[model samples]
Target: MARVDRGAADVITSDGHHLAQYAAPLRRATVDDPVALPCVGDWAALTRLPEGRYELDAILPRRTAFVRGGVGRDSRGGLSGDSRGQVLAANVDVVFVAEPALHGSDFADLGRVERLLALAWESGARPVVLITKSDLVGEHLAGLLDDVAAAAPGVDLHAVCSVTGEGVEVVRNHLGGSRTAVILGASGAGKSTLVNALAGEEVMETQQVRASDGRGRHTTVHRELIPLSGGGLVIDTPGIRRVGLYEMSRGVDLVFADIEELAEECRFSDCAHESEPGCAVLEALESGELPERRLESWRKLQREAAWMARRTDARLQSEETRKWKVIHKSMRGRGRP
Candidate 1:
């Protein structure tokens, strides 16, 4: 469904037709499956219930899904101990990692962009670094773009001012040909404004950011897909608060591939990137060949991904043990009868 509101959803069909579908009940076992969840950009088979209403019969396998850890909770309503990956969007082709260029956050949020880029690369889709609110940047645009480009290697990066519509067309070109794009960023990053500009209308509500910190409120309450007039789809998501790693080792490798390759030239096989003898990474940093900031971002994400992997393994082990316990309990009950 394009817009999931309350218990109902606004479904869009193959030919751009719209239909209202009542929420479908999910099975207990399938409810916890991230792939089975009805997210924006999910392809599903529809069914006509006996009550003359439509329901999502099946959620087909997604080609590409963007998942993040820490969305699930423990029994006490706190964050879960294990890495519970919540799939944000499905069947996505491109991810727009938007960050605000205006305000003091332009260069300040490069680490955030790096973290999001790791997540985006792990989603099996392309990532585009979008610096929104470009007009507010003035002459610093070129410098800021250079910094962002260095942070995002082998990815498309652009500075787009949605209000003046500068560079918006270049952003839309990435969404052409019925491809699905997902807008991912923190609150007040001008995600909704860019969506409206791409749609050529005010398809989403936008609010001004706080003057003190330039942070925006949660204008988008949920993730919903909006079809663009120029073709393609975009799933607008609410501002993400926590972006803990989601078993994204491959993504981490890609984001830090430059460092990874550089490490191979070190003297020792197990050479850490620290102040070790003949460490290529450290040498590069000393010579200004590599930025210290980029290396720091790489190290942080690597550690986070490794920790999340251990947590994921523990969670799966617990789930397996619980499954066997339930199976044994059922067998005992049947034998007693």
Candidate 2:
């Protein structure tokens, strides 16, 4: 439920304890009125009707929001190029990155995992790396889990097979009530399978992946916020194979904490770690302390994030100009000139 007006509520809890499922008309206010309304997960005062219906009065403020940058449309139905990050959800606590498992022969793809880790870290939520199909990999699983841990420092990592229920209990224990988590990964990454195991029901659909290609078919098509039977909420988004780093500079540093720490000891305070004198990051590589591949990945993500930030900022500035122009035009349309 949430605050609506002087003493009214814009939303209330449904009998299902889900989002308020009803949309009521303004009793005193008429049509064509602007909406300054409440959103999901808001607390509202309610007036119960004899028919067992309820009315929302107001929307309480939100604690936090999960957002991503997106483009806006213009009058011609084309993208204005001006973009802004749209809020995906609010009050999320954990970001579950369900990734594909690597059997003995091939190493699990670390690049993609790093990107997801950066995204999760940037979301201001705890990131838990859930590696699926550990049972299939047999004894070689330990090395793969270690690789993931090395890729993402200071994050909880788990390997589970939905079929065998391996490590499922550990994953469930992390989702304490009142805390929310968002699941992100590629198609066929076993996100739905994990969610089903956590929810203790088959709420989401799942598909079998192609053995030859190592890719799974898409089962979930929409971004839905599902309530776990235990207590907290889990937002299951569609299979996201590609996650573009829009503006996650701070997140990059956090994800590559070791490299960042090494750079701090460089001779120059602003050392770029690229052919620079007295570069500690490079020294670590030569001394076998840091792998060259890890440093390269760090540089790639940093560059991409920086570039994306520039593009997004440019789009935002253009959008702000357009909004002001429209407002000025509306003002002139109302004046006698």
- Relative to the unseen true structure, what is the C-alpha lDDT of residue 217 in candidate 2, on a scale of 0 to 100? 77
Candidate 2 per-residue lDDT, tens place, 238-324, comes to: 787556664675778888999989999999999999999999999999998998879999999988777778887786688699989
| TM-score of each model, in listed order | 0.91, 0.78
Please give the range of 10 consecutive residues that has the lowest summed lDDT in model 1: 20-29
Candidate 1 ranges with C-alpha deviation above 4 Å? 5-8, 14-25, 72-82
Cα displacement (Å) at residue 234, model 1: 1.4
Residue pair clashes in candidate 1? none
Clashes of 2: 19
- In terms of lDDT, model 2 sits at 0.72
Q: Which candidate is the best by lDDT?
A: 1
Model 1 lDDT per residue over 1-337, tens place: 6765544556777656455454445544355665456677777777767876677666678899898876666788997534777778888999999988856644548889988989999999999999988788788888999988888889999888899999999999999899999999999989999999999999899999998877799999989898898899998999987887797869888877789888999999898788789999999999998999899988888888888899889978998999999999999989953
Q: Which stretches of candidate 2 lie over 4 Å from their true place?
A: 1-14, 17-62, 71-82, 327-337
